[model samples]
Target chain A: MSSKAAQKQAAPDSPQRVLTGRQFMLGDHACAEGALAAGLDFFAGYPITPSTEVAEHLASRLPAVGGRFVQMEDELGSIAAIIGASAAGARSFTATSGPGFSLMMENIGLAAMMELPCVIVNVQRASPSTGLPTMVGQSDILQARWGSHGDYGIVAYCPSSPQECFELTIDAFNTADRYRIPVFILMDEVVGHMAERVEIPEAKDIPHVPRKGPRTAPGTGQFLPYAADADLVPPIAHAGDGYKVHMTGLTHDERGYPSLTAETHDKLVHRLVDKVRLNAADIVDFEEQDVDDADCVIVAYGCTARSATAAVTQARAEGLRCGLLRPKTIWPFPEARVRRLLEIGKVKRFIVPEINLGQMRREIERLTQLPTLRLNHAGGAMPTPNAILEIIRS
Target chain B: MSTPQPNDFSVVHPIDHLMRADRLPHILCAGCGIGTVIHAYVRAIDESGTDPDQHVCVSGIGCSGRAAGYVNVDSYHSTHGRALPFALGIAVHNPSLTVTVISGDGDLMAIGGNHFIHAARRNVNLNVICINNFNYGMTGGQVGPTTPIGAKGTTAPQGSIEHPFNLPYLAKACGASFVARWTILHVRQFTDAILRSMDKDGFCFTEVLSPCPTSFGRRNKLGEGLDEVEMYRERCHIENGAENLQDLDIDIVDHEQPITVGNFVDIERTAFHA
Candidate 1:
C-alpha cells in the first residue's frame, strides 16, 4: 500500500511493513515497545507506582535485543547512569513517578546543562509529597517546566491513551536527539495502567533523529563541544571517540572548558534558552475538534482529555456550541495556536479540567486572559463526563 | 629561530603528560594536598598500565573537584557530591573504560553520603579516591561530615559536637572490595594502593588525608601547608591489614593516639555488571 493509503485506512495494516502486530497490551508495556522501536538499548530506572511495569517490561526484553537494563540504587543513580550512557553514545531513557521524579530534579538539570540527549518518563501520581501512589494527577505540569533551578528549556509530550503513549515515546526520542535536551513524556497513573489495542508502525516507517556528532575528526578542526552551529545547538561527541571533551555543569565556553566570566555566562545561557524558545513553532503540537463556531472550548490533556472528549460530544448533541482542544505537546505550550483561538472571538470562554488542582489552567488563563473557568479536583479519581458537561452547560 | 628545549621540570614530573597543560598552575592552595594526590593518581594510572585514553575521571564540587578539569582525558566535573553515581553510569555503560571518581570528604560523605554507601554496597567496578581535609575547605572552612568532634570551623565556631565519619570503616562496611587510608606524606604508599585497586573487579576506595592550610589547618593550629605535612609525618602510623576499621577514627580533640594509616581491607567480590 502507498503511504497515503496506509494513513487513510486508519487500520493496523500498512504498505511498507508492519513493525509490530496489533495486540492487547497495557499502556506501560506499549511504552516499552515504543522504546524498542526507537532503537532504545539502554534503560536505567528505579521502579515506582503506575510506572514500574514500563521498567519491568524493558528489563526482560532489552537484553534479548542487545540492549542493557540496569535497576539503579535509586532514582538519582537512574538519571545519572542514563546521562552517562547517553554521553557514551547510546540512546538511553528512564521512567518514574512522583517521588522518584523529585529525586531526579538535580541530575535532570545537569542533563540540560550538559546538552545530553536522553528521555525521561514521568508517570505522574498525585503529590505534595507522594500523595496517591496508585492514582493519577497532572500536577507535575509546572514542575516539568521549571522543576530544575536555572534558566533552560525542555520538551514534554502528554499522551491520553496506550496508543499515543507508544507513538509519542518514539517522537520523544527523536525530539531529544534533534534538540540535544532532556525530553519528558508525562503520563499519569490511569493512562499508564489502562489496557488498549495499539498498532506499531514498521520500524523503517517511524521517524528517527540520531544525535549529531562532529563531522570533522577530533583535533583536525577547532571543535568546541558546546559551540552552537546555526541551530543554536551543538553536536555531541562520545567519550573514547578521541574528542577528549570535558563536560561540566558550570558555565563554560564552546570548547567545553569552564569559562567563569560574566560575558561567557550570558552568551552560553542565552543560547540554551533560545534553542528551544525560537524553535517553539516546530515543537508545538495539539489536536483541535469543532473548535471554530463553538461558544465554549474545553482544554484538557492526558487522562482528563479522554473524558473531555465524551463531555464535548454530549454537549454538541444537546445543541450547545462546545468543543475540545487536547494538547499533544504540553511543555513548549502551544501558545501561538491557543492565542489565535482566543483572538478570533468565536469561543466565548474556556473550561480547563485536570486531575490536579488546576495546574495547567493557570497557564491557559495566563495566555488567553479570557473568562476561563477551572474544573478542578484533588485527584484519586477521574472527573466524570457528566460533571464536565454540567460545567459546559452552565 | 628554533623551538626552545622542554624544561627539565616537565620531563621529570610523573604526571606531566597527564596534566592539561593549558590548565596548569591549578587552583589548589599552595599547601593543599590536592595537587599531591593528582600527582599520585597520574603515577598510579601509569603504573597500572591502563591506557590514558581509556580512562575517565569524574569529580564533584570542592577544591578537589578541580582535579577532573585538569586531567588530560574525558572528564566530568559533576555537581556537588554526585561524582560516584555519574562515574558509575560511565563505567557500567563502557566496561572497557576504567572509571575513577575523585572528590573531597564533604563532597563524598556529606551531601553525597547516600550515593557513597550505596555505590559501595552495589560493588560497581569503579575506583574512588576521596581527599579528606576534615572540613569544607573550598567554602571558607565550614564544618562537614568528616569534621572531628569538638573541632573548630566557621560553621562550628563554638566547636563542632558532631563526630566525623571513619571513611575506610564506612567503605568496608558498605561492601567495598578494597579499602585503604594514607596521608599526603605517604605518596609512594598511596600511589601503590591506587595501582593495586585498579586491578580489582569490584568497588575500590582510598582515602587520602590532605592538609587544608588556608581553612582547615589554620584554625586548628596545624601550621602552614608544610607544617601540616610535618604533623602527618609525626602523628601517622601504618597498620596494613588491620581488622576493625570502626576503631580507626581520627581523634583530633584528645591528640594522644596515633592516626592509623594503611591498607585495611582487600577482598574479592562479584562486580555489578558481571
Candidate 2:
C-alpha cells in the first residue's frame, strides 16, 4: 500500500474552462493536500474531534495519489506505523487531538532520540485528559515541550490561518527532515476544523525541502552519522543505504553507539540540545502585526492569534493602542521578539489570553516581567475577545 | 606494504565480525551476565555472518541499555519500557538488520510488557533478550517483572503477592517464532539459545534468568542457601518446548512450572516491514 506518486489538484469534468484564480479549501483539508503535495506517501492515524477531516480526507485522497492510508488500531499503533514508515524512507505523518497526542509521546521520544524525521499534527483541545474533545484549547503548550522526558529538543509550529496550516505543515515536514528531529504542528481545534479562504498555491511557489543522505560509503572514515555540519543536521544515510548508521534514545557518541562515560554523555546531550537551539534563527518563524503606535501587546499563538488580531482591531477602534504578536514557530519560543517588544517600549502591559490555565502566560510574565494576567479559560473553550479586552482595559 | 589489516589485531576475522562472535566491542564488568550474553551474541553473529553494522541492538532504560553503547554495531538505547517499539522500528525500517532488544525484565515485562506482548503477537523479526535479574538491579534492586513470588525483596516486603512473568511461555502464547529461557549459570546453554534465536527469523525471545547476587541475593534465603551457580542448575531444564503450561510441574518458591528453556516456537510468517 505504498507508492512514490505525487499528489496533484483534482481535475474537473469540464477540463478546458480556462482555470484562473485559486481553489478554496478547508484548513484541515489543506493540511492533507499540503502533505500530499510535499510527497507524503504514508499516513496512519485514528479519528479524533475537529482533526478527523484531515484523516478522512487523506484516507480517500492518498489512494487516488497512489499512496498508502491506514486506519490503525489506535493512536499508539497509528503513530507506531507512521514512525515505522518514516524510518523506511516514506515521508509520513499523523494527526490527532489531546488523548491521541498523549499516546504518540512514547514514539515521539523515540523519534527525537533516534533522529528520525516525522511530522505530528496536534489539534489542541481542552484537557487534563479528554476534558473537552470537541472544543478548542491551547493548554497543551507545556505538554508539547517536556511531555517526553530526557534532555532533548523538539520543534512545534503554530499557524494562525488555514493557509498557514497548509503552508506550515509543508514547513513542518521540511524542518523535521532538515534537523533530523520530530516537528509538531500544534494547531488549535478552532483553526484546524474552521473553513477559510486558503489559496492552494501551485507547486511552483511551494518551498519544498528534502532530507540529505550521505555522500560517501560505509568504509569511508568521515562517515559519523551524528556528526553535525553547519545546518546542525548530519547527512542522514538511510538504514538500507549500507552506510552502517545506528540511531537510539540512549546517550551516545558521534558514531551513534550508546555511550556511558561522563564525557560522551555530556558531548552527546550537548549536541542533541545545542543542535536545535543554536540554529534557532534558521528555525524560528513568526509574524508581528501593528506595533507602530501600540502601548499594550497581546502575545499569543495558534487560534488565539486569530482572536488577538480581532481584539487589536476592536481596541484600535476604541482608541486603545494595541499590537498583536503571533508565533509561527512555537518552540524555542520567540524570546527575542518579546525582548524586542520590551526594547522598543511598544509593549507596556503584556497580556496573554491562552486557553490553558496560563502555560505560556508564565513565559510572557517571565520574559516581559510586566503584569501578565493569564486571562485563561479552562478546557473546552477559547478565550473570548471581550474577556481579553477587559484585561487590556484593567 | 605495511597496511594494517581489519582482522589482523583480532582473533576472529572481520567477516565473522559482521554478525559473528568476535565483533563485540564493549567493556565487561566482573562476571556480568551481559558480558556472557554478548559472548553468545557475537558467537551467534559469527555463525550467522550478517554485516557488523547490519545487526542492530536496541535496549530500554537500565544497565542493559548500555549494551548498544559498547557494541561496534548498529545499536540503539531507547527510553524505559520502549526497546520493543524501537527495535520494531528498526526491524520495519530495514529487514536485513539482525534486530535485538537487550533490556531488563523491568524494562520489558514490567513497564514494557504491553509493547513486548504486542511485538510478540505481531511477530516482528527480532531477537529480544530480556535480562531477568529478579530485581531491578539498575535501580538498586527494586522488585522486577521477573522477581519470583514469595521471595522477599524491595517493594515486596514479606513476599511478592504478584507472580512473576513466565517469559518464554508468554512469548509462545503471543505468537513469537522462537521462545527460550536460560540462566547466566550455564554459559554454553545461554549461547546456544541465543544462536538459535538469531537463526530463527521471527520474534525470537530468550529470557536469560540472571542473578543480581547483591539485591535479590541478600534479601532472599536463595542468595545465602543456594549459590548463584547451583540455583540455576537446580531450577532450569531443557524441554521439548511443545509442552503446555498446564503439563509442566515445577517445585520452587514461585511453584508454577519449571523454567523450560529451548527452541519453543519457530514458525513462518511475514515480517512487519516485509
> By lDDT, who's the top model here?
1
Deviation from native of the Cα of residue B71 in model 2, angstroms: 3.4
> Native-contact recovery for every candidate?
0.50, 0.29
How good is the docking of model 1, as DockQ? 0.34
Q: Report, to 2 decimal places, the DockQ of model 2.
A: 0.22
TM-scores of the candidates in the order shown = 0.93, 0.82
lDDT of 2 by residue, A179-273 (tens): 88888889888888887877765565567788888767676656888887876677787654555556666666677765669998777667777
Report how far off residue A299 is in candidate 1 (Å): 1.1
Q: TM for chain B in all models?
A: 0.94, 0.82
Go through the candidates in order and give the clash count of each. 1, 10
Interface RMSD of 2: 4.8
Chain A vs. true chain A, TM-score per model, equals 0.94, 0.91
Residue-level lDDT of model 1, residues B20-77, one tens digit each, is: 7677778899999999998888888888877787788899999999888888778888
